[model samples]
Target: MKSAVEILSALAEPTRLAAMRLLWDGREHCVCELMRELGASQSRMSRHMSVLRNAGLVVDRRDAQWVRYRIAPDLSAETFALLEAALALSGKPQRVAA
Candidate 1:
């Protein structure tokens, strides 16, 4: 498991933190969808996602030309608790229409 600092570092970025909130509802979100919703360019979004992925804060899978993201489901209780607290401080993320 990653240290607390690493995980916190991942979420420290505004873009990555927002992306996590979008995935908080447990829905798989495509990179393009996130890009559109977050107003990020493709390369920029991918880079942010890579940081989250590397920290094990998120996971992804390929779907044709797109990649999907979601919060990592296998987090330890401790990590989840920490994240919950951090997110609580950030307020609610805007909802994306289905």
Candidate 2:
């Protein structure tokens, strides 16, 4: 269970916030795909993912040689509401790499 501060802190960064919004659709995404979509380097994307994961806002699974990430399924109602609010605030559509 993550505290509100931890969750907010994790999302305070631009990259992490964008990553979370990208994952809000409930689809798992490959790190490489995220890298391309965000125009971020692999290392930078991984670090941002780490912050989301550590904050319990996302979950990662090993898929062969690649790691995939998605919003955590076990989030509390408050966390879900917070995410929803954030998503609502990000009115612009995210360009997810296909």
Candidate 3:
């Protein structure tokens, strides 16, 4: 399990932070969706998701050749609140990219 410090540190990267913000809607997003929305290459997006996964902030499942991810549903209330606070403090409106 990742420590709280590790999780917070993961969010410090802009790509990971933006990805988390996109996933904050509490819905599943396919890798392709995230790539297109974030303008990230497949490998780059995968790397960012890996960090988020390691932090326990997100969960993913494979769908044939694709993968889908979402904010982890099993996060403790306290951890969830921390994520909520981080997103709130980001100062960016939550919306899917064009």
Compare the candidates by TM-score and give the number of the best one. Answer: 1
> What TM-score does candidate 3 get on C-alpha atoms?
0.88
Write the residue-wise lDDT of candidate 3 on 36-58 in tens digits: 99999999999999999998999
lDDT of 2 by residue, 1-98 (tens): 78888988898898888888778778999999899999999999999999999999999999998899998989899997777776667673543432
What TM-score would each prediction reach against the true structure?
Answer: 0.91, 0.89, 0.88
lDDT of 1 by residue, 1-98 (tens): 89999999998999988988888887899999999989999999999999999998888999999999988889888887777777888996443432
Better of 2 and 3 by lDDT: 3
Q: Using lDDT as the measure, which candidate wins? A: 1
Residue 30, candidate 3: how far off, in angstroms? 0.4
Better of 2 and 3 by TM-score: 2
**Which parts of model 3 have CA positions greater than 4 angstroms off?**
92-98
Q: Tell me the deviation in Å of residue 81 in model 3.
A: 1.6
Ranking by lDDT: 1, 3, 2
Error of 2 at 98 (Å): 19
Candidate 2 structure lDDT: 0.85
Give the local distance difference test score of model 3: 0.86
